[model samples]
Target: MASHLDLEEQEQLEQVKAFWKRWGNLITWVLTAALAAYAGWQGWNWYQRDQAAKAGAMYDEFQRAATAQDADKAAAAAGDLKARYPGTGYAAQAGLEVARLQLDKGKADEARQSLAWVAEQGSEPAYRDLARLRLAGLQLDAKAYDDAAKTLDAVKSPEFAGLVADRRGDALLLQGKHDAAKAEYQKALAAIDKTQDYRRIVEAKLATLGVPTVVEAAPNAGAVQ
Candidate 1:
């Protein structure tokens, strides 16, 4: 009976060895892949956090220079931020600030370069729209009517539709396209928010073109929270 029991134990050990031989390599590979993926995920999180922290520090330096009204310092800091951390929101904001400073210092060409960069490369649509609007305004002031029109045409955000139409009207008016300008102003009036003070400015613009002003209706009480 003991010998029979020993033979059965030996048979069970052999079965276990056979199962390991068939499946052990696949199990090891699966566990290795899972561990590598986990490590990669952790590394990605660490990298993002490090980038944000560095960008934040750079932004602080830019803000200090801007507040001091030091155009050269601000421009340098902004250039650094944009170069090192173009993906960060701070970089786009820095570009806007740098452009404003350059403009204030009568560096029109430099200002245009900064604004063009933001318009072309800003991560946020809103920032790009703002840059385009400002850039078009500069072009208009310089009497580059065709360029201003082209810049305004590039603005595609619905939120900026009214402003773009208004700007387009201004460009057309400068080019002596009175009828087209009037039509654009009408479109601007239709699209502008009724509550904005700027809407009244659009109304005044229409009046200058001999178009009757449309009064905005007051909001219904039921529509108020």
Candidate 2:
């Protein structure tokens, strides 16, 4: 009986060895690949966290410089953040600050460049829209008529519809298209909340074009509550 049991155990062990021989390399390779992928995923997470932390600190510095009205310092810090962390949201925000400061400093061309980059390449859609709006306004002021219209045309926010129309009206007025301007002004009025006090400004714009006020001083026309 002992010899028989020994023979059975030997056979089982040989069978196990044969299975390993057939599948060992494949199993080992699969395990290696899985472990490597997990390590890579963990490394990627750590890298992103580190980048965000650094970018956030730099952005705080940029904000402080902006608050102090140190335009040059703000621009320089923001530029550094943007160059080093262009993939971060903070970088896009810094671009906005730098653009505004440049504009305030009468650096129109530089402002346009910064604003255009933010508008076209910002990481967030909302920030991109805001940049486009501001850029459109600047271009309008510079009489870059076609460019302003094109930028404004790209804005698709429902909330910005009224403002865009109002700006378009301004652009048209500058181009001596009073009739078209009036139409756009009317659209702006229609887009705005009738109860918003700002609607009065739109009304005034329409009045300037000799269009009969459709929403005079109705108490409800400018009340929110």
| Cα-based lDDT for every prediction | 0.93, 0.89
lDDT of 2 by residue, 65-115 (tens): 998888889989988987898888998999988889888888888888888
Backbone clash pairs for candidate 2 read none
The parts of candidate 1 lying over 4 Å away from their true place are 1-31, 215-225
TM-score for candidate 1: 0.82
Q: Where in model 2 is the C-alpha error above 4 Å?
A: 1-33, 156-159, 193-200, 212-225
Best by TM-score: 1
Q: After TM-score superposition, what is the CA distance of residue 23 in candidate 2 from its true location, in Å?
A: 6.3
* lDDT (Cα) of model 2: 0.89
Each candidate's number of clashing pairs is 0, 0
TM-score of each: 0.82, 0.77
Residue 82 of model 2 has an lDDT of 75
Error of model 2, residue 83, in angstroms: 0.6
